[model samples]
Target: MTDDKSKRDFRDRNRVAGDEEYEVGYFASKFGLSIPQVRELIARHGNDREALEREAKALGVR
Candidate 1:
Protein backbone atom coordinates (compact mmCIF):
# COMPACT_ATOMS: atom_id res chain seq x y z
CA MET A 1 0.00 0.00 0.00
CA THR A 2 1.14 3.48 -0.78
CA ASP A 3 1.05 6.44 1.56
CA ASP A 4 -0.87 9.57 0.63
CA LYS A 5 2.25 11.44 -0.29
CA SER A 6 3.41 8.54 -2.45
CA LYS A 7 0.06 8.29 -4.16
CA ARG A 8 -0.07 12.00 -4.84
CA ASP A 9 3.48 11.98 -6.07
CA PHE A 10 2.70 9.10 -8.39
CA ARG A 11 -0.28 10.93 -9.82
CA ASP A 12 1.72 14.07 -10.25
CA ARG A 13 4.57 12.28 -11.94
CA ASN A 14 2.30 10.40 -14.28
CA ARG A 15 0.75 13.50 -15.76
CA VAL A 16 0.32 13.20 -19.50
CA ALA A 17 0.84 16.07 -21.89
CA GLY A 18 -2.51 15.17 -23.50
CA ASP A 19 -3.74 17.84 -25.96
CA GLU A 20 -1.75 20.61 -24.38
CA GLU A 21 1.57 21.85 -25.63
CA TYR A 22 4.47 21.06 -23.31
CA GLU A 23 5.55 23.90 -21.09
CA VAL A 24 8.93 23.83 -19.41
CA GLY A 25 7.64 24.76 -15.97
CA TYR A 26 4.74 22.31 -16.06
CA PHE A 27 6.83 19.37 -17.14
CA ALA A 28 9.60 20.32 -14.77
CA SER A 29 7.26 20.36 -11.80
CA LYS A 30 5.40 17.25 -12.85
CA PHE A 31 8.58 15.25 -13.35
CA GLY A 32 10.47 16.71 -10.41
CA LEU A 33 12.98 18.27 -12.77
CA SER A 34 14.42 21.71 -13.22
CA ILE A 35 13.36 24.06 -16.05
CA PRO A 36 16.68 23.73 -17.79
CA GLN A 37 16.57 19.96 -17.43
CA VAL A 38 13.10 19.88 -18.90
CA ARG A 39 14.25 22.01 -21.81
CA GLU A 40 17.22 19.73 -22.34
CA LEU A 41 14.99 16.67 -22.26
CA ILE A 42 12.63 18.17 -24.82
CA ALA A 43 15.54 19.29 -26.91
CA ARG A 44 17.17 15.87 -26.92
CA HIS A 45 14.00 13.77 -27.12
CA GLY A 46 11.20 16.00 -28.35
CA ASN A 47 7.87 16.08 -26.50
CA ASP A 48 6.88 12.46 -26.88
CA ARG A 49 6.10 10.94 -23.51
CA GLU A 50 7.68 7.59 -24.22
CA ALA A 51 10.87 9.08 -25.53
CA LEU A 52 11.10 11.44 -22.62
CA GLU A 53 10.54 8.62 -20.13
CA ARG A 54 13.15 6.51 -21.82
CA GLU A 55 15.68 9.28 -21.87
CA ALA A 56 14.91 10.26 -18.30
CA LYS A 57 15.34 6.66 -17.19
CA ALA A 58 18.62 6.47 -18.99
CA LEU A 59 19.70 9.55 -17.13
CA GLY A 60 18.60 7.97 -13.78
CA VAL A 61 15.68 10.32 -13.25
CA ARG A 62 12.71 8.91 -11.34
Candidate 2:
Protein backbone atom coordinates (compact mmCIF):
# COMPACT_ATOMS: atom_id res chain seq x y z
CA MET A 1 0.00 0.00 0.00
CA THR A 2 1.09 3.51 -0.66
CA ASP A 3 2.33 5.47 2.34
CA ASP A 4 -0.55 7.80 3.16
CA LYS A 5 1.12 9.46 6.11
CA SER A 6 2.79 12.14 4.03
CA LYS A 7 -0.41 13.14 2.31
CA ARG A 8 -2.55 12.85 5.40
CA ASP A 9 -0.18 14.80 7.63
CA PHE A 10 0.22 17.57 5.12
CA ARG A 11 -3.50 17.99 4.52
CA ASP A 12 -4.41 17.64 8.15
CA ARG A 13 -1.70 19.84 9.65
CA ASN A 14 1.79 21.23 9.06
CA ARG A 15 2.40 22.65 5.58
CA VAL A 16 -0.30 24.70 3.90
CA ALA A 17 -1.02 24.02 0.26
CA GLY A 18 -0.65 27.26 -1.58
CA ASP A 19 -3.05 26.28 -4.34
CA GLU A 20 -5.76 25.34 -1.86
CA GLU A 21 -8.02 28.30 -1.23
CA TYR A 22 -9.50 26.81 1.92
CA GLU A 23 -6.07 26.37 3.47
CA VAL A 24 -5.18 29.90 2.59
CA GLY A 25 -8.42 31.18 4.06
CA TYR A 26 -7.86 29.20 7.23
CA PHE A 27 -4.40 30.64 7.74
CA ALA A 28 -5.67 34.10 6.88
CA SER A 29 -8.38 33.84 9.46
CA LYS A 30 -5.98 32.45 12.03
CA PHE A 31 -3.56 35.26 11.45
CA GLY A 32 -6.23 37.92 11.06
CA LEU A 33 -4.88 38.74 7.62
CA SER A 34 -6.49 39.08 4.23
CA ILE A 35 -6.37 36.18 1.79
CA PRO A 36 -4.06 38.10 -0.50
CA GLN A 37 -1.63 38.77 2.33
CA VAL A 38 -1.55 35.13 3.30
CA ARG A 39 -1.07 34.19 -0.35
CA GLU A 40 1.78 36.64 -0.64
CA LEU A 41 3.39 35.23 2.50
CA ILE A 42 3.06 31.73 1.14
CA ALA A 43 4.65 32.82 -2.11
CA ARG A 44 7.52 34.53 -0.40
CA HIS A 45 8.06 32.10 2.45
CA GLY A 46 6.68 28.88 1.14
CA ASN A 47 4.00 26.81 2.97
CA ASP A 48 5.72 25.69 6.18
CA ARG A 49 3.21 26.27 8.98
CA GLU A 50 5.59 27.38 11.75
CA ALA A 51 7.50 29.65 9.43
CA LEU A 52 4.31 31.22 8.18
CA GLU A 53 3.06 31.75 11.70
CA ARG A 54 6.32 33.43 12.66
CA GLU A 55 6.22 35.60 9.58
CA ALA A 56 2.63 36.51 10.20
CA LYS A 57 3.49 37.54 13.74
CA ALA A 58 6.41 39.52 12.37
CA LEU A 59 4.00 41.20 10.01
CA GLY A 60 2.03 42.21 13.13
CA VAL A 61 -0.89 40.00 12.13
CA ARG A 62 -0.94 38.18 15.45
Model number with the top TM-score: 2
Clashes in model 1: which pairs? none
TM-score of each: 0.49, 0.75
Task: State the displacement of the C-alpha of residue 9, model 2, in Å, after optimal TM-score superposition.
Answer: 5.1
Flag regions of model 2 displaced more than 4 Å: 1-12
| Reference-based TM-score, model 1 | 0.49
Model 1 deviation from the true structure expressed as Cα RMSD, one decimal place: 9.2
Name model 1 segments beyond 4 Å from true.
1-22, 57-62
